[model samples]
Target: MATLLAGMGVVAVTNAEAAAGCKVVYSVPSQWQGGFTGNVAVTNLGDPVSGWRLTWAFPSGQTVTQAWNATVTTSGSQVTATNASYNANIATNGTVSFGFNGSWTGSNTAPTSFALNGVTCTGGTATTTTTTTTTPPPTDDAMAATAAMQPGWNLGNSLDATGSDETSWGNPRVTAALLDNIRAQGFNSIRIPVTWGQHQGPAPGYTIDPAYMARVKEVVDWALADGFYVMVNIHHDSWQWIANMPADRAGVLARYNAAWTQIATTFRDSSPKLVLESVNEPQFSNSSGAAQNAELLHELNTSFHGIVRRSGGANATRLLVLPTLHTSADQARIDELTTTLTALKDPRIIATVHFYGYWPFSVNVAGGTRFDAVAQKDLTDSFDRVHDSLVAKGIPVIIGEYGLLGFDRHTGTIQQGEKLKFFEFLGHYARAKKITTMLWDNGQHFGRTSFQWSDPELFAQIKSSWTTRSGTASSDQVFSARSSAITDKSLTLNLNGTSFLGLRHGTTDLVRGTDYTVTGDQLTITASAITRLSGSRAYGTNATLSARFSQGVPWRINLITHDTPVLQNATGTTSAFAIPTAFRGDQLATMEAKYADGSNAGPHNWTSYKEFDRAFAPNYTTNVTTLTSDFFAEVADGARVTLTFHYWSGAKVTYHVTRTGTSVTGTTS
Candidate 1:
């Protein structure tokens, strides 16, 4: 059974009893005048346990105010801390620790005893450790390793590009200088995705081309030499062959194992900084449901684990990353990966998932143009789930790729202000959740040839988010009507923990009271300032102002002066129909087209508001709105459809169009 030796201050439990024997270390790592931070480490010394709960009674009157890595609650002098979802299992000799901030009065004393799983802990010790210090985790500590690789970047559309070679995707060849530039840009790690199926031989061998392998090594070596934690993975091959695991299980598994065998052998002596990901966004085709998919992925992961660990050299202890089905952050996917990780029983394993934000908002479709509450909730919920499911349990998680899906078309698909807010908030929240996020570049963000960011402002916000929060506002644009008297415009500022200093225009500071004023979180620009800034009533952006803050990047505010945009009648063939238009400095937001009976008449018929750039696109330089063939193809022939063009300036214009077979006519009636 179990024996408790009260005089010896120890408890002896037998494995036959299935009771837990544990040791607790409680220390006050830091203390202020009336507050302190407490850290407790629970080490299970006997009988592996799952879902552990540790309880203790405080000797002094200390109240826990906040906690991390555990769910902690206090009742008077008694306190209890339970394992989080992801970290519920503590194998024999495994240690799980958590910390908290508490308020103390006059005196602070560590608890003399602690219990684990209702069994009194033996060898419990309490100390007021004056020095705030932490021992660096061992080399194979995946949690510490992944945490050190924070704020990573993806080398996208290059090696992973589905083509003949690395440069086939239009991005230039990888260069050492590029690695230098990335390091200079504040990225701590780089994920190099290599698509192997196209470069591999057929059948049993499935041998990857030696030259392609060498090239991949060159890039990985460069990153490692630059002191960057590098991750190399099989990218698009997931769809090329791995996804067909259900239909051709043996063949897929053979090829998959062969690929990893060669890869691990090649990088077997590489630096410990190099990490191997089993597969990128692992998936299954023709699977019954989540159960089969999970089983299929588990097989691949187990095989990968075996191949890499047996390859010897650094591969023996190398950090390995595994992805859930589709690398989605859904709870089921996370739990699936958790089971795989636990089955592998490897401490150097990390779970990876990709996030492109909420679908509708990510693509700027269905009028999800703004990063509103729904979108924000989606992001927070996903992160919270991942944090609780993986990170909190001592298992690290890496957001392999994160960005707006619409970024593929172009950044302009989403408004500048909304995009900034999304990135700013994403960076801040990811850091808060203790999860590392890697931006999915795909050559859209950083320019390869120029070695510069395509959008400096967006990059600035992203870079700043790596460290601290940046202030943002409700909207980045202050629209002023050119035909009417200028009125004061106000924007709600999101201080994000920093105080706004003031506003400036091209280096000249605006007078706080005369030109602008800040009351609480509302920043207002005076009417006189708007009138002056809108010099000559320009049709587009008349001026730009920078909102300075105590820290982080400055938020840009554009003063846009515009009147109601005008559209002229035009006629053209079905191949091309460009409505003559004068934007008058206003920007198109969305378009709506409907027939006489109010039925949607565009490509996306479910909603009257059509997808920007897909159905209808505005060409400010050409001064025309071109209705794409996609839109006309779906329109009823010989039926007149009324189109409503909405602009960012809050102005809407109505026009009518009739399609008669090959020809089309447009009118403002």
Candidate 2:
């Protein structure tokens, strides 16, 4: 990247550039081929120019590489740049000025001449600003989101405010000032989840409670002032808004269209920084209730892209996020639809993916075990799965929500150490893979809020770095690490004062697979990745092992031999379950450890236990790391069937499927 420091007054900021009519039109910004900023202008000078185009001849060195908003087609010294489809409707007889921002390794100088519609324009020279702040570039989505920040504390409870006692988040609730903390922490975007229904007036005339919305506006206004990419979406208003969406014969479609129209138009002229996400997690289908819900969400999807595009400005070119049924990680993979977003013509259809492959932990069981080591590889080979698919047909993907949720339910203390480890790992991997991710912190836990951070013991542990918090892998460093047990099968390796997080060899014996036996005293067994994701037990100071099974329960001290390994020292909770509830609907079987507590909570702590169980059913199978189709063997061709819906609502229902190297079409009963 090139940084050119110009003396004062070298850069011009005229009154025309700041005028109300000066709309700051779509002079799109592109990726930084180099780091620098400049000034220039093109005037109409009274003669009306139909459909304006900018052509500047670089002085032998300023060859255009890549540009956005405007596409540049270069042939030698003369570079021709034109407004991409969305920005083609520029007016004539009006002076338009658009500059570029990029990097240059060679000498930085102003382009010698500029031609507007083949006619030479004046004021050809400008200043180039140099910058030294070179932070790691964010994934594409991150850049777009950070670019959309409408600075403000998320109106978490207030937006959905049944007006009960305000359930404030982050007690000095996230305000304008909180933005500094967000930026400092390397976060690039903020998504504001809103509920317009509760704030609507007594009448159904689309007249929302201006005061309630104003509170939200205050936050967006702050974010805009701070210059961050902000996204505001309809969150959790489905019951009263999306779900209860009139399930009629014909009027339903009209209501849906008018609703989004009002929403899109209301925020149309706001600011380029504000991005409108179509909807939140709208549940479409389960085993039951599939038709109406399915039809509504489908129509919503078909309308969102077009609706936001019609909003204009950045909204026209602005990135729109599309969520799927249940916002399922696998559901977002649209394998069955021919046109994932073909109905819309906008170039900025950013397919939205929510992280929390294990949502049971984030919400239902907040403060679960740290999955840093696991959430890491889950990104590798799968990034391009959805984006590439859409891009081929013309679309991109963005990871809008992801966070290491380690706020313990029992203690309410944020599991900072392990959770941050998860974030740091995902952040690095996400950025490297070119996929952006937003942290899902409502400021409730994770050593951020007052109540949680109040504990001195937890605070100190959370403040310290779990793995190196350096945030970047230095050159010559062995980054992009892919670690597996020297063997992927079951085994216990000791840490042996190795400065690593593992068992000590002198302190633990190893198992190779999942067959264990107890012959009076000695324990014997085998092991596998299934066993690896499960819990284990400590046999002695120098030995650790898995628990033996006695009627499907761990018996403690499982010694796995090539032959007959056995388990010893069995202990059981006094109260027993009529039937023990284990991990269900788990496709990958990421992990499992027998956890039971005195409070009668299931498996409070696995501490040292045995046996990870394979889930019997999976809603959908995906590569946990890259989250795409078939991280493993593919589902047989005739084995799958999809159910599509027909609704009066203006939405289209699509199911993502990876049909191998070919295509397959069929229907469900």
* Cα TM-score per model: 0.78, 0.45
Q: How big is the positional error of residue 329 in model 1, measured in Å on the Cα after superposition? A: 1.0
lDDT of each: 0.85, 0.40
Query: Which portions of model 2 miss their true places by more than 4 Å?
Result: 1-174, 245-259, 285-294, 311-314, 331-333, 336-338, 359-384, 387-394, 404-421, 445-669
Show where candidate 1 strays beyond 4 Å. Answer: 1-138
Can you write out model 1's per-residue Cα lDDT over 124-212, one digit (the tens) per residue? 55454552112222456788778878879999999998999888988899987677666656577899999999999988899899999
Against the correct fold, how does model 2 do in TM-score? Answer: 0.45
lDDT of 2 by residue, 1-669 (tens): 333222222122235322111111222121223333333344444234435567766553655532433566777666776643323333433444434443345654556455555554442233333221233323244334433331122334434444421344323444554543343222335677776665554333655555665677777766555445567887766555566554442443444465567667767767655667777777532323545555566677777667767667555665567766555445333542224455554455566666653433332222233343333445443444544554344454456665433332222222223333344444444444445555454544333332232333332222222212222111100101012221222222211112211111112323322333333333233333224423242211112232311111111222211111111111111121011111111111222222122111113232221111111111222211121122112223323322121111111232222222334332111
The deviation in Å at residue 631 for candidate 2 is 36
